[model samples]
Target: MAKSPIVFAMANPNPEIRPEQCDGLAAVMATGRSDYPNQINNVLAFPGIFRGALDAHATDITEGMKLAAAIAIAESVSDADLKPEFVVPSVFDRTIVERVAPAVAAAAIKDGVIRKR
Candidate 1:
């Protein structure tokens, strides 16, 4: 039997939106990709990053500041190496969580979100 495909949907709950008006959400769906994409959810990112931070004894995580961290991770994969189906590196990629955590931690410091070391 073939495996069913998974599509990621980015839904925003807003009473003023359309198509599922009663649901009050605008959905931006990812038609073909992993079970989830970055825009759809942070499921791909948080766990490993947290593990790395904990391993490194981090105090906090931040908001927009983390964008730099993600960029660093994404950039580690060259644009020539990227395809729509593979924008993010696999969680199993040994360098990924290790490379990303420092940037996130630094971002937290820069954003004033980390009150401690």
Candidate 2:
């Protein structure tokens, strides 16, 4: 068995398969629609990434910063609260940007691409 596969149907407007079809099957289900849980939108990371880069005065956006932002986003969902429906934090979560910003800033500093200390 695949051991409960992760599925990202993530099409705009309509997903490849509705989450309802996967009930009791998928380990994680994601789509681009706001109506569904774990909506896989780029907004989950971009704004915070830009904010962190600007805040850090980064001369260049490096892979490290992106990786850090991804980690922050993933960690935003606490292990205790994690569920198939909540693999990613809600986009409206105020802490999303806060968590991503500092992580990205730290990565920028560590990567030595920041224009200022």
Candidate with best TM-score:
2
Model 1, CA-based lDDT: 0.52
Which digits, one per residue and each the tens of the lDDT, describe model 1 over residues 1-117? 123323343454421222223122322324223344333236446754676455445566555546756776677667786654455566556676667777766665565665454
Clashing pairs in 1: none
Best by lDDT: 2
Off by over 4 Å in 2: 1-3
| Model 2, span 4-105: residue lDDT tens | 989999888989899998888889989999999998899989989999999989999999999999999999888899988889888889889999999999
User: All predictions: root-mean-square deviation over Cα?
Assistant: 9.6, 1.7
- lDDT of every predicted structure (CA atoms): 0.52, 0.91
How does model 2 fare in lDDT? 0.91
Error of 1 at 116 (Å): 4.0
Steric clash count of candidate 1: 0
